[model samples]
Target: MKLSRPLVLLAVGAVVALALLAGIAYIFKLPPFREKGEIKAGEVCSSLGSSSNAVDALTKVLPEESSYSFDENIDLRTDVTDTNFESSCFVAGGGKQLLVAKARLMEDESATSWTQWVKGTASNEVSIQSLTPFTAGDTAVSSSRFAAVFVPCTSAGKAPGGQYNLSVSTELKQEGNTNDAAARDELIKLAKNAASYAHVKAKCDMAPNLGGTS
Candidate 1:
């Protein structure tokens, strides 16, 4: 049918509008849309090794109305197995993967470079002072966008070593510098909470250092 010019334009506009809505839905992980991928309770700590995570549900850590809540969906892209697990979680904001947390088991007593905290304790590099919050753990680190904890996991890990280490990493995309200090401190706190969560779930031998909650 040969429609009038205005009518043709109106139809085109409707299609474009629908496409825009679809794009928004596809880009942002809107609530009630991807119910199957929802992050249930107690999932955040173990999210480093599982598809389910606590990021979206960590109101205590990320805040209920934080800008991160408006970011893209949670992506759990890792290689985990039934016995051993090594996984990472990321907030895929604007196509940039900002690591939120990664949990893994390691037997490398001399392993370093995983995080600034690990590197600093391993060596006395001059720039080691840049490790923002040095009180995260026995070996840990923190920044506006990073926090990691390496704890004794004699009972937690199923790996070969009778005694090993449990590592939990946390970071986020830095939106601004106005609150960098507070952000670094908060990340350090998050890392502590995450370490505790994993310790209990994984049946670790000892509690995390975490600089005694500050």
Candidate 2:
């Protein structure tokens, strides 16, 4: 059967409109409204590197008065899986002092949740004398005059169901001018900066404590 002129014209107009919309979308790179996720978390990180920003983050924490610099060879590495991401960097300063800044990302599951503060194991060989809370994470000061922090990145609102952990360890570093007190302070500051840069939540009022006496 032959089609009516008006009906054929209407059909042609609809096709042209669709084609024009498609061309506009392609030119402007406009994604459809019903893409996938709601673009939650603003921008979820993916290109977190090991030596790139990790080294800068670690170096920024070093005390200016201390005679320390990143060794000629920095032992830093990073890894990422479907459910986890981690970055670590080793720092050397004052001839015999060492510090490590590490960050971890994992699914926001109950068992491995990053919100709570967990104490580290301490024994004769590994003696964590004090465990306290920092503004951005947990702090542990060891008997060997060591300092560290375990931070969970939960400040960005819990939309994606994942958390972040930023840990700093100075247990291996020998006694130097920068004692546990100073090292602990530095680590806490580092954590605060990390929270801001990485868009994580931090509890600054939780100010770190030495747990025991002072």
Candidate 3:
């Protein structure tokens, strides 16, 4: 059959249109888009370690005798509520990626000077299934692990009494296969020292008491 020039043009246009539609479909078939959030597990760990080092350097600048420690097994929990607070960040090699999680404390209704809005907001950020609850002595611990870039915190000006206290506790596991009470005690002591140093730094960062009798 003999084809006219107009027919050839029409066929070509149809082929082009089909190709364009296929390209568009392929683009739409991609995985659901998500915005990238800050630091991975490895990065967070490095940052936390770096922060500790920075504190040490700062202490050297001071005239007072300074001795600080770092807690390897830190437990974070909330005093205002029965629920515990925990977080962990780690990076896996191979095809697996890194994950960083930040768990915030929840407020109990019975607790005094508690902020409901802040608690609600923090709860929303928590991944419930990932959270693991544990207890040490009389204290309750809650922890969660995730892949994140930044540590989440309560929104400014939303906390109760314009203050939010985060308590971090740490314990040391056995060095080898054997779990000894003495080793555990030693680890706790080191962790307590670290926690004490961290508390001082936190207080300074939050509010510096400049006006006091020297």
Best prediction by TM-score? 1
Clash pairs, model 2 backbone = 155-201
Write model 3 residue lDDT over 1-214, tens digit each, in one string.
9889999999999999988877775675422222222222333232133444423322222112112222232345433322344433222222233222222333222222222222232323442223332322112222232111111123235455433433333221112222343323322332233333433433312321112111
Instruction: Assess candidate 2 and give its TM-score to the true structure.
Output: 0.38
Q: What value does the lDDT take at residue 89 in candidate 1? A: 49
Off by over 4 Å in 2: 1-82, 93-97, 109-127, 137-172, 194-214
RMSD to truth, every model = 11.1, 22.6, 18.5
> Candidate 1, which ten residues in sequence have the lowest lDDT sum?
63-72
| Residue pairs whose backbone atoms clash in candidate 1 | 44-54, 136-210
Alpha-carbon local distance difference test for all models:
0.51, 0.39, 0.31
lDDT score for residue 107 of model 1: 50
As a TM-score, model 3 comes out at: 0.24
How does model 2 fare in lDDT? 0.39
Model 1 agreement with the true structure over 70-176: per-residue lDDT tens digits: 22222232222222435444554334443355566555354354553354332223323356536554577665556677876554344444555667766654233
Clashing pairs in 3: 38-149, 39-149, 73-170, 75-169, 86-142, 86-143, 99-147, 100-146, 100-147
Off by over 4 Å in 1: 1-83, 94-99, 108-129, 155-159, 176-178, 211-214
Of candidates 3 and 2, the better by TM-score? 2
